[model samples]
Target: MSDVEIICDKSFSDVDSEILDRFVEFQQAIIDKDEAKLDEILTEKYELVHMSGKRQTKQEFISEIMDGTLNYYKSEIIDPTILWDDKERATLVADVALTAKVYGINGKWTLDTTVDFEKVDGKWYFTKWDN
Candidate 1:
């Protein structure tokens, strides 16, 4: 076989780092129950799929949070990996331990989570998440 060269380019750039930082902020917003900040960080089309196969739309989710129906006390993300499909779309996968009260049940859960983000108007917003 002839000599061949292969290039592997999977390194995260500064922009990607910034996006990851924003994601961490997003997690914090949930823990802090900051409705306004969550509003800014989540896209209008955001959706969440719970581990129990329940789904919530953006407004429904936000309303639950605002009403204290779904409260997040804390979240610790471990070994996050980010993959950008293009300039506008990215996926972040990580193992996370989260403490929360949902639907009147309070518990701590460790889960493997996949979060999707989209870039709109030069800003990144969380579009969806599932575990």
Candidate 2:
């Protein structure tokens, strides 16, 4: 039998376009409520550690986006910072703002979030986030 080796070689600093691409796709997914596309981008180990110290799984997170429960007129990332490690992992931190469509629904503002991504088999996947 031949030995099989898996290489995770995608570096984060060089993946600015990939990160931006994911952001664009994420924006489109949110705007269109495309759960499938959103699911594909998030890793199974995804977790959102909120500013208030709440943790949510990828499924739960996607559910919020898909169910219109967290109806955001516009959710955007601003002033992003990205870092990569030798373990084939990446991190992104950015400020975010979420505006609601209707009144009485106050929008949200948050400082930079810390997101961890793993480059598994060369494809980057969001694994964890903390604000």
lDDT of 1 by residue, 1-131 (tens): 21111122355578877777787787777767788999899888899998998999888888998899988887777667788899899998877777889889999887778999998898889999887
Each candidate's clash count: 0, 0
Q: Mark the regions of model 1 whose C-alpha exceeds 4 Å error after superposition.
A: 1-12
Estimate the lDDT of model 1: 0.80
lDDT score, candidate 2: 0.65
Provide the overall lDDT of each model, using Cα atoms, as 2-decimal numbers: 0.80, 0.65
Model 2: worst 10 consecutive residues (lDDT sum): 1-10
lDDT of 2 at 54: 72
Residue-level lDDT for 33 in candidate 1: 72
Candidate 2 residue-wise lDDT, 1-131, digit = tens? 21111122444455865764565566566556778887888888889786668788989878876766655556566666667685577777667665543224566655466777777787777788787
